[model samples]
Target: MVGVLAAAVAVLAVVTGLNLVLLFAVIRKLRTTEARLGTAPVATLPKQGSEIGSFLIAAEDDSMISDASIGDGMTVACVMPGCAPCKTQIAAFRERPRSAPEKTVFFVFGGQGEPETEELVTSLAGLGQVAVTQTAGAVGVALDDVTSFPTLLRTEGGRIAAVGRTWEDIGAVAVATVR
Candidate 1:
């Protein structure tokens, strides 16, 4: 009986040791897989260093906004109504100015006649030029990566210097202004 107990303990120890070894092997494989994928996240935001395509849009206030609108150090924030995160993102932007008001352009996505769309556009006017669109439509077709709401980015020389959901990720690169 004593021999049997000792053998059982030894078997369990070996099994545990083998499990640890396999765990380490799996972790190593996952790390390699991540590296193989180039560390590009599955986010909808455009990849940093990629150039944004040109566009000419009509702001809700009848202003003509173009690619030049975001020239140099402008920050572009795309948000949508009914998305809690979008509201939070904008609220944060309003509370803490990350870039110059003139350098920040907001694209609000929603149905053409939706009341919430108008409200969103109105609220963002204090920030800068605000555009209301029936959908991601043109912007989506142009920036393919801008399919998600609450995307914040700064472009420099037409290339995306930084892109993220929060200002902290892009704040430093944009034209600085306090509110």
Candidate 2:
């Protein structure tokens, strides 16, 4: 009876060890699979990059401008509303060469709800900058890998030059770019 009890304890210890080993193997496999999928478990915003494509967006003026219609020689700054930094950048942008005929920075407002989005437009308009309407679909296309709000994309010479989630001294950056 004593020998049987000792053998039973040894078997239980081995089973526990095997279970731990299996758990580690399964975890390692899941990590490897995630790596292959080109996506992290956590969401990350996209970094500054070039234009993936040009597409037209609707606006309050009842007009439309397709991405292809944008002149290659011009630099377009597509902006969204309700972004405090965006408002400051827009204010500073108006004073920069970006407003010059050659640069042509276009404001594009995109938000989740119509009322909130309209409020953004009103706020920007009050600041004296004309903004176009960016539908939810267009916003999705414009922002690639953007996980949060307040997105600013700079397109120069027909390609995306830089993009950021915030302004962080954007006036200096804008001035430096056009000058």
Give the top-scoring candidate (lDDT).
1
Q: On residues 7-53, what C-alpha lDDT tens digit does candidate 2 reach at each position?
A: 99999999999999999999999999988986745534445455645
lDDT at 42, model 1: 62
Residue-wise C-alpha lDDT for candidate 1, range 1-179, written one tens digit per residue: 99999999999999999999999999999999999987876656778888777778898778888776678988888889887888897887777767777777888878777888878887787788788754657765454458777888888997788888888888643344543
* Each model's lDDT: 0.78, 0.54
Model 1: weakest 10-residue lDDT segment is: 170-179
Off by over 4 Å in 2: 1-49, 73-81, 94-97, 101-113, 126-136, 142-149, 165-179
Residue clash pairs of candidate 1 = none
Clash totals for all candidate models: 0, 5
State the TM-score for model 1. Answer: 0.69
